[model samples]
Target: MKFSQWIGFTILAFCVYILWNIRQLLLLLFTAAIIANFLNHGVQLLQRIGMKRGSAVLSSILLSLIVLSGFFLIIIPPFAEQLPELFKLVSLGLDQLILTIKDFILRLDPELIKALPNSQQVVEQLEPLIQIIAGQGLSVFYTTLGIPLTLLLLFALTLMLLVNPSAYRQGFIRLFPSFYRKKIDHILTECDRSLQGKLTRILFKMVMITMLSFIGLSLLGMRLTLAQSMLAGILTFIPNIGPVLSLIPPVAIALLENPWKSLSVFVLYIIFYLVISIIESKFVAPLLIENRKSILPAVTLLAQVFFGISFGVLGFFLALPLALVAQVWLKEVLVKDILDQWKSNYNYSHQEFTSELKKK
Candidate 1:
């Protein structure tokens, strides 16, 4: 490579290195941007209804806080009360399971007992996990929910963005070449609209899942139906693995009640997951995005896995939206404009459009 090309490559590598180092912070900022984008819609609506910009922003923030406060009120208390019980029940369930195993083992031939899983050894392996849950389940649960300081920092950044989004937007657009700034701005707008549709669809899915889970749990006579159903709903915001996480609490409680019923609970949740997936893919999604081409399941799963590995939990939470942003830019800029426009650059007879025109 030429000396100048080498220099440019080194600078690009350094930039990527810096970005990698700050990836977590970038994810956090992106999260804040998403929140701000949604809030901005409310601010825009209020402004259209004759409120001043300042009043609209303030009202939007206040309204957001109210909704958040209500969400916490609904979630926190139920989880606080049920979590410990859930943990205790899970512990008892394990013990009961071990007892059943032991009894079966005692009835079996001594050689066969040795061949099968030893109840005592199984308990020894699971002992630490059971102890941790019994000892610090609530702390773990709350920590997973999030730390207050981190959440505060997140919202503060969101407010900053929400206050004057257009300024940040234009500043970002200015970073592109003058000739391409318009195109960049248009791409950003597309991303924003795509993101809004995704967020709305996600919210719709959450509500539907919550309702469906609640009724399913009730029909199955599951313990702590409300808390488990609510958990199912909230976790629906996450992509692939959320359903698995939501399955744990009910299954644990079911195990405590009856080992066989735990199997039933497991099967029931699998059904609910499938039902919700079908409902969203068939009904909710199309209404949310007009002419929305179906995204590949493998691609969505790949995004979840890639983001979860790269960005940890935050990436998993934002995976779909992040993927949405990438998809919009790639589709509009690369596939539609660059690739399609560049087709004329080739004089190959194998080109279908050119060949068809010649045939005509």
Candidate 2:
């Protein structure tokens, strides 16, 4: 490589290194941006109904808070009270399951019975896995502790963005050379549309999944029905893996009843999610999101794995929106502009568009 090319490469590497170090803050900012984008959508809707911008933003925020507060009020106390009982039930269920398995093994072969680990031995074997789960629980505890302060910062940032989003939009455009600014602005619009569409669809899925899960579990006479259903609903926001994770708790509880009951619970979850997935892929998504295609399941899972490794839990939470944003920029800047070598109006009319936007 030429000396200048080598120098540019080093600079790019340094920039990436710096970004890696500041990834947490970047994730936080991006999260705030995503929230701001959704709130901005609400603001736009309110504006169309003849509300002022400030009132619209305030109304949107307040409406969200009211809904969240209502759920917390209704659910938190019951969930907390039932949690210990749920754990006890799971432990009892697991013990009975182990005993049953041991008896089955004994019937098969006396020697196999002797080889099979008893409950205490099995617990010892699971020590590491239990410790890992405990550590994760602690991490969740710490995250919960910090949520208030984090939400404060997030809300503040979101409010600032909502107040004058066009300024940020224009400023970002200015970072590019004047020739590419229009194209970049167009790209930003595409990102906005994509984010909005994904967010809308995700919210709808959450509601539907939660409702379906609750109804199904209730019909099956599952304990902690509310908790399981709400958890399933919330986790549905995490694509591909969320439904599987949501299955664990109810299945464990069912094991307390009997193996057949456990199997029934497992089968119920499978059928419920299959129905949800079919309906979503066939009708809901196509009806709701008009512009962009849904993220491929492989792509969503890959993003989750990559981001989870890179940034931990926060990464998993923000993975889909992050993937959507990355996809937009990648498609527009890399594939279209660079690889495809698309012709640009910069050859003839760059100033015309910039001036018109500036006047607006």
Candidate 3:
């Protein structure tokens, strides 16, 4: 390559390296952006009803704070009190389950029992590996011991962004060449709309799941039903694997009391989740987000692994949102414009683009 070309390549590589080093900060900023977007919708709604921008933003922030405070006040105290009992129940449940399994094995033929490998020996061999993995995971979390500070920074940033979102949006647009600024602005608008729709759908699903789980657990007379349901609801944000993890605590506690009750709890969770899933797929999503493409489960899992490794637990949680945003940009800029229908000039006018975007 020519010397100028080599210099350009070197500059690009250096920029990438710098970005990689500060990726965590970027993720936090992205999170703030998502929060700002969610809040911005509320601001816009208030504006439509004749409220000024500042008042609208303030009202939205106050509303969010009120909801959060109410949730913590209602849920945290009881959950904290019951935590010890919950752990004790889990231990008893495991013991009872093991005994039941042993009794079943004893009824099997002597030769069949003899052929079975020793579970204790297998566990012993796996213990060190499990401990190592767990230690590494804990260490990663320890490295993020300042997460509260990070969260504070994020909240502050979101507030600042909310106060003058147009300034930031315009600043971002100004970063591009003058000719491409319109297209970039259009793309950003699309991304914001997509993220808004995704979050709305998720929040709706979470509320539904929490209510259904709570109702089901109450009917079954399960202890800690509120805490269990809330946990289930929050974890439902994680997609495919979340519902299974959510079932473990309640099912284990129930199993300690009655095997039949344990089975019923499991069935109840499955039915509730299945119903929610069907409604979400069939109705809720189509009504909420008609324009955005769904993120595939496999892609979501891959994003989780990548973000989890790169940014730890917080990253793992934000993986879906990050992936969703990335998918939007990739589809609009890379796939649609560059790959699928690359055209030179083609009389691309702002009005024509706006018309096309509206149709989309």
- Model 2 residue runs over 4 Å out of place are 1-7, 87-147, 281-283, 342-360
lDDT of each: 0.79, 0.80, 0.81
Question: Deviation in angstroms for 195 in model 3?
Answer: 1.6
> Across residues 17-80, which tens digit of lDDT does each residue of candidate 3 receive?
9998777677778889889988898899999999999899999999999998997899888977
lDDT of 1 at 2: 100
Give one digit per residue, the lDDT tens place, for model 2 in 247-321: 777887888776788999889888887787788778777665334656799999899877776666777767898
**Cand. 1 TM to true fold:** 0.74
Comparing 1 and 3 on lDDT, the stronger one: 3
Give the C-alpha miss distance for residue 49 in model 2, angstroms: 1.7
**lDDT (C-alpha) at residue 147 in model 2:** 61
Cα TM-score of candidate 2? 0.78
Candidates ranked, most accurate by lDDT first: 3, 2, 1
Candidate 2: worst-modelled 10 consecutive residues by lDDT? 132-141
